[model samples]
Target chain A: MFVLASASKARQKLLDQIALRHKVIVSDFDETQLQEPDPILKVKLLAKGKADSALKKLIEENHALNTYQALLGCDSLFEFKGEIFEKPINKEQLISRWKRMSGQSGFLHTGHYLISLDNSKSDMESISQNNSCEGVVSTKIEFMNLSNFEINKYASTSEPYNCAGGFAIEGNGGLFIKKIDGCFSNVIGLSLPWLKNNLEKYGLSRLLLDR
Target chain B: MFVLASASKARQKLLDQIALRHKVIVSDFDETQLQEPDPILKVKLLAKGKADSALKKLIEENHALNTYQALLGCDSLFEFKGEIFEKPINKEQLISRWKRMSGQSGFLHTGHYLISLDNSKSDMESISQNNSCEGVVSTKIEFMNLSNFEINKYASTSEPYNCAGGFAIEGNGGLFIKKIDGCFSNVIGLSLPWLKNNLEKYGLSRLLLDR
Candidate 1:
């Protein structure tokens, strides 16, 4: 079993797609307070922060953190024309983002951190020395050459407000996507192939197989 | 307003994505009976046949076919290593197809036919001689290197049984897709960019704008 250290529905849906048994635990990490100059390191640090925060909470709440073999955390960001974009907070920002991103290609970077728990350790001090693995998946996504009317129309809807880069590749905004150049799952929130490759190292690939 | 000449849920969902008001009427044209050596011509002919059949059905049912500006028909096929693949008939075929398609790239060809309906036409005969426009959008899709266990596990699901090439780019099978190189919507059964560009020529792009 695995514990997911995030609250994204897309990540949960992805886990369900692969039939992975997992538990969701929302982290209390404040992402807005985190910042870094490098885009790649930024996401990696955030994912680590989320995992650490979630694990700390589980330990405090007396949850069975040691029962699960692995704890997963993830963070994603959109890079368009040298600028990094997080989720648009309002309709105006979404409209502006779409206008700049229309007919353009951008990179979506998702970072994953897996904390492996040692069940043999009974004390919190020993658990502090747990092994954590990390990986990053980047995908290039191209948006359709949208008209002004189309941009405004999509911005008026609530779809863009809740997604990174003002669009959801798996939702209604899917039609506006022109193409992608890497792991499709990474664009959705996580990379199954990347996860499988990492999980193989821990001898947990069986967890992904058919029940 | 537009009339859709097929019953594919993906196409309907795409129409809804773009906020296009339309009605669906399944074409009676038998896809199995239509075949052409050239993949492009094959899809175009089938799309034309579907549009023609759907227009005739509307006239028979007295559904005011002339009121609509355009009647859209679409058909898609997957070409892997020069062979055409439609929807798999059984699980065995799906497993076999996935074995050959794993870690490979394929072309998804979607043909769209828009029959321009002139409202001035009072009878079926004039409507029968209406002008029609056609376009074909082909997308290159790359599949992840999947293990036999993964392939078999996904093949057992109902997602592979109902889609062309034994996989759906928009469903659970999406995780298995590595990348796409053209119109993403084309792989989903309709090419929105192609459709919007074509619709613009008929002065009907407004139909796609805000209601």
Candidate 2:
């Protein structure tokens, strides 16, 4: 069994499509604590934090799941014009974000980490005898010129507030995107390709068989 | 009524999502006739050719629908390492293309033409008007590394053979994408935001709403 250290529906949906059996465990770390100019590093740190938190939680609860094989943690952020646009706080903030993003381009960065857990410390050391892998994937997005009315109408759906950059690429907000220059799933809040690649490192390619 | 000048399930699914009412008319133009180094130009030319072909067919058939306002034509191509990768010609070619793209970054260019059929009086005028509003939107895609076994497995599904660039960003191909850098729909063979923008320019926002 694998543990997913996130509450994002997009990430869960991606894992589900791949037919991976995973249990959801939301991380307890506060993302605002991490500060970095480079969006990639910030997201990577958050993913790492989530993984560590999940590991600690399982230990504290003395859960039998400690024998589980792996834990996956993920985090994403929207970077536009050299600034990071985190999740919005309110409708006005979402509207303002849309106004600023009108006819502009941006990057969506998703960081992923895979942590291997073993019941015995010796087993963990044996697996690490080779190499552990972790990485970040980024998707670029171009916004079409949007009018105030269109922006307001989309914002009213309240889908943008919970998503980074105040837009959910897979939902109603899809209409505002002029073009995408990278992985569509990354903007949806996870990178399925990246996950598949990492899973291969563990000799776990069987998970991808057509259902 | 709107006329769509192409037969692509991906594009059809997009229009359906937006609830746009339209009739599909497959183009009879020979795509191999065009020679262009720039992928953007290639797709735009193909799209325009398709629009022109559809228009001619409509006139020759003397279709009863009189007040059709807008006509849409679309084309897409896969670009990798400066080379344009059109749809795979055979199973072997499709497998090779999938192998090459298993863990690489690429771009998908989708061109759209929204022609105002009601405004076109003569064939010359129709061609001129079609050229004015046509544009290409490019979406970037990055794939994660896959082993030969995984590549062969995905290829066996035969999903990549019919798709431009040998992968469907919205279907099983989602497993291979690490991130997308532009419009998700563009990679799927349409650009909803671009379509919406063009529609709004003609005071046809109601088309989207009325759906």
Candidate 3:
């Protein structure tokens, strides 16, 4: 059995795509407290924090955390040039970001962390990053040169307020994406190919096979 | 106003992405009757036929066809090597196609035909393909090396029976697509960027901007 430690609908839909059986337990980790400036490291830390917090909650609930083969957590952020973007806090910020992102290629980095609690790990290394397997999937997204009218139309929608980069690739914003040079699923928030490859290392590929 | 001459949910969703208000009137054109072996020509004929049929129906119903700016029709086919794949006929065919497509790159060709009924064109040339601007948008899609288990699981579902190439990039099959090298929306059944560019030529981009 596998566990997903985030409550994102995109991630859940991804799991459904692969027919993976999993349960969602929202982690209460405060992502706003993360202060890392490097976008990649920041995403990795947030994913790890969410996974660790979820595992702790399971343990506290006497849920036999070791019974589950793996717990998966993921975090994603958008980076254009050198700046990182999460969800915009207001309509003004959202519009400002869209103006800058129009007609440009950006990188979407999604950090995935898998914590295996199979009762076979060394006691000292169980909770450390070294003990867990992690991977970061990146996809290049090229946006169309959108006019101000188009940009304002997209920014006026609520989809930009809850998604990284002030846009949702799976929603109305998909119209503005001209090209994608990497895993399409990564742009949607999770990288299925990366997740599949990582699961093989943990001998959990059978979960997908049997399903 | 624009008229969409197909009932495909994917195409409708794409139209909705840009907030374009349109009416869907399913065309009665028979695609299988096409004898053209060239995939590109076959798709173009199919799109044109659909648009022509829908326009005819609208005229029959006295829908004020001249008042509409454009009528749009689209048809897509997956070309792998030299063969054109529309929908897989059955589970066995779907599984066979997936086996051959595993880890391979193919092209998705979407033929878009816009029949402009704006008040500016001569009555005789308005409905002809020569007067109606058309385009073909092609996107290269790379599929993951799917396992037999994965292929069988996906083939068991009805998703493979209704879409070109027996898989949908916006659905479960997205898990197996590793990369895309052109417009992503083209793979989804329509190319928004291409549509936008073409609409500009017809002075119909105003439809989107004014919305």
Candidate 4:
């Protein structure tokens, strides 16, 4: 079995889409601790922190080697016009962000960190020394011009409140996306291509549990 | 209600994803009659044909005006190395196609056709003259290198059999897609932005049956 170190439902559904045998174990780490200035590095650092924190929990529970083969952590942030945009805190923020983002292009960066529990040693020091993989993928998303009414109506829906960049590409927000210029899944959450590549490299492709 | 004039489940789910209230009415159009050579035009003509056929069916049943607001038809084709690919005929063909497609990039073109039932005239002649919209969207898709075993394993599944380009970006085949360089939804079946644009233009954006 594999473990996902995040509580995002989109990420969980993405794993299920690929038929991967995985379970969600929300990381205990505080995401706000990372105030990294660089948009790309901010997500990367947060993902790494989440994975490490999850690993610490698994080790403490003495279930690292036997129950799960690996742990995956991912975080995404959007950069528009040299500004970092995380999830909007409220409807006003979301509406204001949409006003600025309408008819514009932005980059969404998703950082991925994976820890393999293949080492014979179960100690914390040994796992850190032995197995891990990291990568970041970005997708350029363009939105169509939106009128005030369209933006307000979209904000009224429950789709945008908790999602990164105030939009969910796989939900109602899909109607506003003009086009994407990179890994589509990366924009949604985790990059399936990136995940498959790493899983194959670690001889964990067998975990697909394809239905 | 909006009518979908094709048999593609992906397109239906796409409309649903955007909270659109639509119904499916698979066209009885003979797709093979069109021998169009241009990948872009091939899909466009087929989409138009399907919509026309479905309109004819609705007209015959005298249900076009009262039961639905519009009908949508879509068709997709993949262009790789100057050749057009529809669904593969068999497993051997699918495997061979993947071997050529692996580690390469290709274009997926999806054509969209919509017929608005806003006009009061119910006869076939009046409908053809008054309300229709057409467009085509394309996405450049790149594939990751796959070993023979991986290719064969994927081919053994039912995912590629009925899908255009011998792959489904929303399914297990997502593992093989490196990235897409255009509208991601078009690669699946319909272009959500395209549909939304046309719908909004015709004052039909209210079709969104948001839950």
Stretches > 4 Å off in candidate 1: A66-69, A116-131, A209-211, B66-69, B118-131, B209-211
Report residue A16 deviation for candidate 4 (angstroms).
1.0
lDDT string, candidate 4, A157-193, tens digits: 8889878899998888988899899888899899999
* Candidate 3 ranges beyond 4 A from true positions: A62-69, A117-131, A206-211, B118-125, B128-131, B206-211
Candidate 4, CAPRI quality class derived from DockQ: medium
Candidate 3's residue-wise lDDT over A1-211, tens digit each?
A: 7789999898888888777888887899999898899989988889889988887776677445566777888899999999999889898888888888888989999998888765545552455355478888889999989888888887777787888887777777777888888988888888888877778776777766245
Worst 10 residues of 4 chain B by lDDT: B119-128
Interface RMSD of each: 2.8, 2.3, 2.3, 1.3
TM-score pick, better of 3 and 4: 4
Candidate 4, residue B106: how far the Cα is off, in Å? 0.7
Better of 2 and 4 by DockQ: 4
Judged by TM-score relative to the true structure, which candidate is superior, 1 or 4? 4
Model 2 ranges with Cα > 4 A deviation:
A16-68, A80-84, A117-140, A179-183, B16-42, B52-68, B79-84, B99-107, B117-132, B138-145, B177-184, B209-211
Task: Give lDDT tens digits, candidate 4, residues B1-211.
Answer: 8889988888888988988888787788998888888998899899998998888878787653666787898999999988999999999999999999999999999999988886445566567447889999999999999988889888888889989999998888888898889888889998988988898878888886456
Candidate 4 regions with alpha-carbon error over 4 angstroms: A62-64
Better of 3 and 4 by lDDT: 4
List TM-score (chain A only) for every prediction.
0.93, 0.89, 0.92, 0.95
Steric clash pairs (candidate 4) = none
The candidate, 1 or 3, that scores higher on DockQ is: 3
Error of 3 at A65 (Å): 4.2
Docking class of 2: acceptable
Error of 4 at B92 (Å): 0.4
